[model samples]
Target: MNTKVSRVYPRSLTFGDTTVELATMTAADAPALAEFVKTLPVHDRLFVRRDVSHPKVLDAWIGALAQGHVTSLVARDGATMVGCTAIVVDPLSWSSHVGELRVLVAPAWRGRGLGRALIQENFALALGLHLSKLTVQMTVDQRAAIAVFEELGFRAEAVLRDHVKDHDGQAHDLALLSHDVAEVQSRLRMFGVDDALQH
Candidate 1:
């Protein structure tokens, strides 16, 4: 579990006219990733558990990455970070097989296939770590996000009523979605990600 050992990724993907470099996040990336998160719209930031806009949280993620507790990937268009995805593995022994996925994409990059690419990269990482389950949580109103997950075969697993309260204390329902790692791998193979998954 040497955190410094880099994970190999597939070549960059081309979406429309842009080419996005896909790579894992390292401790050195904290500052840039933090700045990138801060540029996101408030609505996009609402679903994030870690306030990447805060230095402390970014430092925490750096530490986590160094300890191999989390694996994250970033999509960069040239030098600008456009999207990111992270999978956090459960530390408790009882739930160690489970991991949670967090994804964020710039508003301008939405609906152009970047999100799916990010999720696919996360799936490869989860499989590399031998995790059994992956889960994603989001407010129920994020229909587009939900659709993307569903398209990847993730099923709605649970609903926490009034799970999140906004800045004004208004509550929102949260949806929990999960994907079995084995099933996801099979799906990826069908989609021609077999070579990537083999890594």
Candidate 2:
């Protein structure tokens, strides 16, 4: 219930020039994490279903985060949560081998290659859990997010035209993309990220 509980992550994960120490979500990080969710773009925010907190969703989400089924990783620049990502491992038998990924970067961290690192880490985590696939989406306004997925070897699997109606009743298309973890690992090797990069 105290921030001290999550003040430091018990494990360390590498991310470029920095190491993202990870702590399972605790009540303390709730407020900051919740505030971060508010910063996400409308369409992006809509896709995330925070199931853990009760009256307020992020609180529930934080509780779910402590469970391996839905893991959250926050990147820190000394105490500031500069970036965050979630790997939602599906628990149903039908979706047991798949996980959905959502990543967000604080405005200041954009274009610094952190997004790729966050994704790569999530992919590795997904694979470790024996997941068969990772799914994600981007709306028309998110060109950069789209490019990141493509560069990561995710193919645009579907386009749901006018799938979502805005407040004005104008339909917006959503691009669905997916990546095979094994394939992405193979592709990264061809692109210059060898084993040493993992360290």
Question: Each model's TM-score?
Answer: 0.88, 0.74
Which one is best on TM-score?
1
What does candidate 2 score on TM? 0.74
TM-score of 1: 0.88
Residues 23-103, model 1: lDDT tens digits: 888776776787787778765655667556668888888888877888888888888888888888757568778888899
Q: For candidate 1, which ten residues in a row score worst on lDDT?
A: 1-10
- What lDDT score is found at residue 32 in candidate 2? 71
Residue by residue across 80-126, what tens digits does model 2's lDDT show?
67678777765755876677888887776678778887887776566
Model 1: residue 199 alpha-carbon error in angstroms: 2.7
Total clashing residue pairs per candidate?
0, 4
- Model 1 spans with C-alpha error above 4 angstroms: 1-7, 186-196
